[model samples]
Target: MSDQIILTTSSHLEGYRVTEHLDIVSAECVFGMNVFKDMFAGIRDIFGGRNKSSQNALRDARTSCLEELRKEAREKGANAVIGVDLDYSEISGGGKSMLFLVATGTAVKVEKV
Candidate 1:
């Protein structure tokens, strides 16, 4: 992770001016649900309550995706990423379920305004 890189969902950053528009960068992560978690989540679904397991998985995935995004931006010589977006999806195949998280943003060089 690059501490110098700023990440934001907004298109504009306060106290910074975009000097150059680099390119769009994206990162994706996939997490597989274990059998025990699936069972507990199913139970929680039936009870109509929050599923901590799934929530934690998503949180970790988002964090990892953001880290990857920051790395990509740094590699591109970008000091900030704006217009960031996150997407989540689930895939079920071969009797298994997996969660996918994708983060995208426009890498840009920014200077203090």
Candidate 2:
């Protein structure tokens, strides 16, 4: 633990949580399943209609990725994860889609004698 950390004095949360803005100190990873979703999207595009299946799959992927990030944060001894950001994209030339979830915040350890 560093002296600059405010929460270091108290034996409470390891770090502060800011839902509106997640701090940037660590890495951001992604997890998603879009192989089948993309295929449906392409089919819907040809018919000029909405691709509900693809959209739902993307949403599911985003949720799953976020959960994974939360678990990682917990393992890293983080009290809470803030400033979470999510994104979805379709890879070019590959019939695959990607769901990215970014969770960022400070990881701190309590100072003890």
Candidate 3:
């Protein structure tokens, strides 16, 4: 697993075993500009209130990140991803926000194992 496969088929599992033995790789990956957004988010928070802009920004970023992961998985010939995880962080000094949508799973050709 290369930490960039978006699973969309399996509900009980993150990955679907299609082959006996094979390694999954992340062929493509995409992410949103988090640093800049985080900074602004922090500023908004300091005002003793929540900023809807910041919330919206994070949501958009997450969506974009996931889309990228799915595309990468498709390119790698993976039907689903396992052990999917999402990580978010703020830049130092609250300068920006970073969203990392990572997915990991085994890629294999389907057959009787």
Candidate 4:
């Protein structure tokens, strides 16, 4: 394996064969929504503009989660991650809401097929 870890959404990489199946690794990121973003949610359509606030939040969370996932896999002696999954959830209460991102995968050791 190289210095960088290989990550794939599929169960296996085409050119590589699994030699050891490590433990399942996961990472989470929580993104908070400001009042302004929520209040202007409906007005965005009137101005015919994209929801930059939401987009930024999603992008940031996704990046954080994936990076953390890679770190977790690497720590467990895994050269690659297979069967990756990303899940998003909304947690709201008391008129406030936050976006939660979770990334999970099976850490594995792989070699050339």
- The candidate with the higher lDDT, 1 or 2, is 1
Model 4 local distance difference test score: 0.86
Off by over 4 Å in 4: 35-49
Candidate ranking (lDDT, best to worst):
4, 1, 3, 2
Global fold similarity of model 3 (TM-score): 0.49
Best candidate, lDDT-wise?
Answer: 4
Task: Give one digit per residue, the lDDT tens place, for model 4 in 1-102.
Answer: 577889899999999999999999999988776643674666754444666655665777888899999999999999999999999998889988887889
Any runs in candidate 1 off by more than 4 Å, and if so which?
35-48
- CA RMSD of all predictions: 3.0, 9.4, 6.8, 2.7
Candidate 2's residue-wise lDDT over 40-92, tens digit each? 65674544465666666657665566566555655665544444445444444
Runs of candidate 2 with Cα error greater than 4 angstroms are 1-49, 93-113
Preferred candidate (TM-score higher): 1 or 4: 1
What are the lDDT figures for the candidates, one per model?
A: 0.85, 0.47, 0.51, 0.86
Of candidates 4 and 2, the better by TM-score? 4
Q: Which 10-residue window in model 3 sums to the lowest lDDT? A: 20-29
Residue 9, candidate 3: C-alpha displacement in angstroms: 12
| lDDT minimum window of 10 residues, candidate 4 | 39-48
Worst 10 residues of 1 by lDDT: 39-48
